[model samples]
Target chain A: MLHTLPELVNQRTTLVRRGRFLCVDFRLSVGDVDYDITVNHGRLVGFTSDGGLLRSWRFRIAAPAQTWLAFWQPVPAPGYHDIFALNKSRLARLEGDLYPFMSNLRYFKEVIAIPRDFNFTTEQDLVA
Target chain B: MSASLEPIVGRYLRTTWQQRPVRIYFEEAGNGIPLVCLHTAGCDTSQFRHLMTDPAVTDRFRVIAFDLPWHGKSPPPVGWQDEDYALSTDAYTEIIRTFCRDLELVKPVVMGCSMGGRIVLNLAAHHANEFAALIGLEAADHQTPWYDTEWLNRPDVHGGEVCAGLISGLVAPQSPDEARWETLWQYLQSGPGVFKGDLHFYRADSDYRDRTALIDTAVCPLYLMTGEYDFSCTVEDTTRTGAAIDGAEVVIMGELGHFPMSENPVKFRQYILPVLDEIEKKSAPKS
Candidate 1:
């Protein structure tokens, strides 16, 4: 049971209910660093850097640190505004099974776009 | 009476195009020279919901938006069960022409976005003498499609969710949450395989590159405005298209994307009102 997913998913009761059917885990890479992203029933449980090699993920969405920085901005630029746009512009690379990615596309989009409040003055801080 | 009526009125019109008769559902508001609106692929008359209600426009222009068959509120033409709905350029052109003639709109201004945008170029190329002007929003001669549309129709995924999800990115992040989600809601309401079916026109059937040189803006003014954030029809695409047409007016709107009118009507109005005003002046009786 997802006791805390509501709070995690914008505290929206509706999303919390809908999240029940969603279960996806993936790896997000910014530069050389890899962050294991887990979405258990629609809740973005966590995205922590350094997933052990033994851990498995369905897909990997990788981008340059600068691309991640541009995307995380409260208001992103034209080409960097969307994951698909990034992939289209070759600013980001999405690999592995796209089935899961397309299956819960909205969930993946919203979860990734939850907007990080982190204040990073440089690509180094973002990668850190 | 707590039930106040909106100024808009809904109605049905019958028109036959390409030997195929279809019942079209259209909504209208305001009163003046008819301004026929064409919505983006997979969307319907609802995209013009805000445009119809805006008094600034309604006072001078009669805004009318119609749903294509197999789209919102409009059912497919009879005998559709055996056919897959594919909107060809010839069919789309004839539909608008027949619709305008049936409605008795005298030289109505035709404005459209996306696939609708592509067709206006065809309209100008072949039928400029019949209309007052042409406005193409998020238009281009051509742009390679960014994503495969197969994901939108597959049984493995929820069709509505996938369609709305893919389209959500096309709306600019600067758009208000209310307007943005409402735009997605419209996509969410699109029928099964309908969005993909419409892509038959947008992704495959419509390419105006070779045809742009044939459009003569002298017969009817052509205005091409594209939102800055529309990756699907990039600013470069609109500008290149504009350059190909000698006298076309080109504009790059800021902080908006593919579905400019639906996703950010307020901002779209700021850019569009001026064009409408210009059109009114162009059509005014010379004294």
Candidate 2:
């Protein structure tokens, strides 16, 4: 799911329109791994595993890999149903500046749940 | 253009809150016992639109839904520029009590959701004699607050949209797309900060745990119903609330979340109709 996050997001042009004015970077931590992601005008432009200094992001959304696994399921249940739900239940943690995140909330939520919408795992599809 | 008229009527009532002149906007339909609805925090009375328009409900019960001051069509108390709005327990109860008196309603069975839900406990505990029955939807004596209320009110945020976005997940995933968005549209149109102002009572001011044991069900039977999908007021919250109050009845609504009536009126009807029927029966004079 993490590997395909960019593809899954870029494919949904209609969903990205809602946050077309937003341009920011954010961090996603699944287990011990981290991905520094950049979104430009609502499209996921790039992301990398580069660590150390000079990295900046509007916010960081971190949860255990298992938590993300449950969240990415085709049909998550209850607390796993939404990011805010996960945050409320304390299964996931959100830190750093929340301005961009809150201002573009619906877009952010829709973008992150792309995996749920596509349920992608195919390498051929990922190559696209 | 094609348009259909609903039997529902909207009107404003002349009233007062703590010696200040006030006006309340409400919509009503049907003809029997008054079913005054209290909407969730920040949002207004539209949450009960389906119930008010349904013949099954209105044919036998007069349904009334009102916007609390500073919500929907109801404006805040005067002296406009200087005050920050906050709802208190006494103020909330008084608003309902006065609305009833102004309408000349006798023993109206009150049903409220979310903030409306929590306040029912206050009504049950201190003013039970004024109501024939109390129904609390997505209700609990208390639930822990999960977010900073300021986010819903601050200047940098689009209060209405952010507010709607935050709560959209609270609606059941099974609800129809139409009903779900309709519920969100209401939040998108909410007055700035009104949702947070109402929270003054929900998360802080209206904690009913200390007084739950004081409610006498024999006076006004209390009913607790919560959606299975509501994390804010989980089933456990309502269950624990029901247990604390003797004779309180609890029901868990399936495939529904916090905003039951508004988000999925079709499914909510299945759960609420029986309860409404029981209330109708209870109010019927003995033969």
Candidate 3:
């Protein structure tokens, strides 16, 4: 259905790189709701919405290519939520650091070694 | 009279031209000139089994139905590419050309249903002289944006592939139909991955509308038909499509959806007989 994320509210953002990983900080507000997201590669590692810890996901840098961050959780867990809430000023600062991190992550992956086989595989066969 | 209700299966013709496997089935009695019937996507010539059995139509002319490449009993081409599976009108035109040449049959009245309809329209547009007349049932009209920007955006339980499987279930009859539908579904899922490839092609290809317009301008007379409730190709859509072709005869089967021929055999025969009669009269020898 509507798989794409909604547009970001605040345009100002930043990104920071550490070793083989990059952190993307961005602020997005929809209606009365706002969220501060710190994304690693394509996965959301740390998230705060409305000045509270929304949720954390198990994220690992893929091998070989190491260009992708794989996010996964146990099968029985509830599904991921779309929106989050966060305070205004912290969101602004986080947004500045997050954008550059995402941009740099994309750049490094493009410039350096490519990532391979980043899909999640369950040990238990769901189909069977 | 031709054999009645008895399953008549025989070896007709087989060829491996253009690296594509081809099989042809020839019936005893068909009126007027030879009519080549092309089935829709995913279905074999068996879908036309009822039409083949009807004496009124078969006695008047020779009806030739063949499996399109990689469908039904026809084997896929060696190392077939996904691009080659769902053909453009140009590719279909070539197939008809090759079929006619190999079978040594003159340009006959070409009638097709669904995907078959699309192919015949392409032939009529580009090579009108090769066919006497053309009939299309629920032919695909719009291209890329129509499906991608619109239909593809709609939410479904298992995407378009599963939706197609559901439609097959609806068309199939209950008693013996269950088995047939199951077989078709299995075939669709496992066969050549053509279904997915074709879906993508329909979404990406931009020339479908242009081809419909081209067919409309061709010299040969064109006939368009669709069921009232046909969700795949609606009557309104068919009406708009017919408007593109000058003097194109349009028929809307009331209370009928897609696959009118299969859904209502009696009514399908009633409508088709007159066309066959007219073609027979035209093709008759003059002294």
Question: Best lDDT goes to which candidate?
Answer: 2
Candidate 2 per-residue lDDT, tens place, B169-280, comes to: 8987788999999999999998878888889988879888899989999999889999998989999999999999999999999999999999999999999999999989
For B34-106, candidate 3 gives per-residue lDDT tens digits of: 7778766555566566677787877666777776566666666667754445555445566767777777778
lDDT of 1 by residue, B199-251 (tens): 88887888888889999999999999999889889999999999999999998
* Reference A-B contact fraction recovered by candidate 3: 0.00
Worst 10 residues of 2 chain B by lDDT: B77-86
For residues A1-128, could you state the per-residue lDDT of candidate 2 as single tens digits?
Answer: 45677787778778677879999999987766678899999888878766675788889998887787777777677778778888988889999998899999998888777766555444323223
Best by TM-score: 2
DockQ per model, Cα: 0.79, 0.69, 0.02
Q: Where in model 3 is the C-alpha error above 4 Å?
A: A1-128, B1-7, B10-32, B80-86, B143-164, B169-192, B199-206, B211-218
Runs in model 1 with CA error above 4 Å?
A1-16, A44-48, A51-54, B1-3
Give the candidates in order of TM-score, highest first.
2, 1, 3
Clashes of 1: 0
Interface RMSD of each: 0.7, 1.0, 18.3
RMSD of 2: 2.5
Clashing pairs for predicted structure model 1, backbone only: none
TM-score of chain A of 3: 0.26
Kindly provide the TM-score of model 1 when superposed on the true structure, using C-alpha atoms: 0.94
